[model samples]
Target: MMMMLNNEESEIVKDEKSPCEKPIKLIELSEKPRVYRIPNFLSDEECTHLIESSKNKLRPCNEISSGVHRSGWGLFMKEGEEDHPITQNVFKKMKSFVNLTDSCEVMQVIRYNPGEETSSHFDYFNPLTTNGSMKIGLYGQRVCTILMYLCDVEEGGETSFPEVGVKVKPIKGDAVLFYNCKPNGDVDPLSLHQGDPVIKGTKWIAIKLINQKQQPSNNNNKEGSCAP
Candidate 1:
């Protein structure tokens, strides 16, 4: 069960026990979609820094090989890697808002330009495993994903979830927080989302933070990747 209590309303979302069961709310986009958008989630200065840093990391790729042609930016946080300052701060804030038990890792920073959009897909992490041991299943667990919009979009660039019929446009300094997996570690099918094509200007952005364990487990793999 996921609960959010505020002065206006207390939101409690219950996950289905079976992995094959469909999400309860089908018509409403916001109802139990596991997606939350927070406007002005980052400061103006912080947003600018993230954009600059990510721009310097962009990598050219073969567009024709894939369905779309787009560039990518990435930064990984290992045990001793220099962490992105913004990502470190956001991770701390996220811990307070949600219940997390394991150490979190910084995955990648991604940006999409005009005519670029990610196809619908689900974010999945490898099942927890110890050193050369059998994988310890942590199915249906919730994995946190945070996206901070670095640049504003004029038109046609929106994050859309076709399963729930939800579309979120890019707003500078705002962030969208979502859970990639469900309470039982089963990846939520309704959470499948995609980036709409950028018709006007380039879509600049950065993603900060990934999963933190909510309970002690033997799982070791903790890397995350994204496509634009």
Candidate 2:
């Protein structure tokens, strides 16, 4: 369908499904690491709201090699991911895209400036490597990540998957998704990815990680108290 806007248009009705939340058309970008990309995931309004909520609380990102500061978007965005009307609405909407309702990590908002970039890393846990282990999740495993682009970059800032030779550009409202583990719960090394250096303009993004929820253990057993 062609998207056209005219001055005579009074109001544009929103679609039932988000521009990028179509579950049926979930495209697979990689099979080894189970990567996917959904175009136009978030809307322009949603992106702006998230950025506004965390504009003042940005902090310097931690880097191992050089504890010194790097020239990133300088906007380490966060907040409004919880207890906000817009957040609740979007969180509930995301439920329609994947299972495991009680299994999402806090949403993270991040911005990157030209020449800034993050090192390659894996989101899932691995028992073999010290750096690959995840110790602070309330779940079994990190499953999927829904990364949305808040704004566009003029030159660079593509999401690069070096292992699979994939690089996704930063387009406002689009999203990149990928699984960190296989069906049997083993971490996939092919999922390794990193934020490529930004070349020209500022790059804004929001990321949410989904995990396998830890099943509540029923340790206590009780006798039947119900009436027959």
lDDT scores of the candidates, listed in order: 0.56, 0.64
**lDDT, candidate 2, 48-127, per-residue tens:** 99889876776545521232333443332223346687766566656656653444555666778889877777776555
User: In model 2, which residue pairs have backbone atoms overlapping below 3 Å?
Assistant: 72-113, 73-112, 73-113
RMSD of 2: 11.3
Give candidate 2 regions above 4 Å deviation: 1-25, 63-81, 129-138, 215-228
**What C-alpha lDDT does candidate 2 achieve relative to the native structure?**
0.64
lDDT of 1 at 191: 73
- Give the candidate number with the greatest TM-score: 2
Best by lDDT: 2
Candidate 2 to truth, TM: 0.74
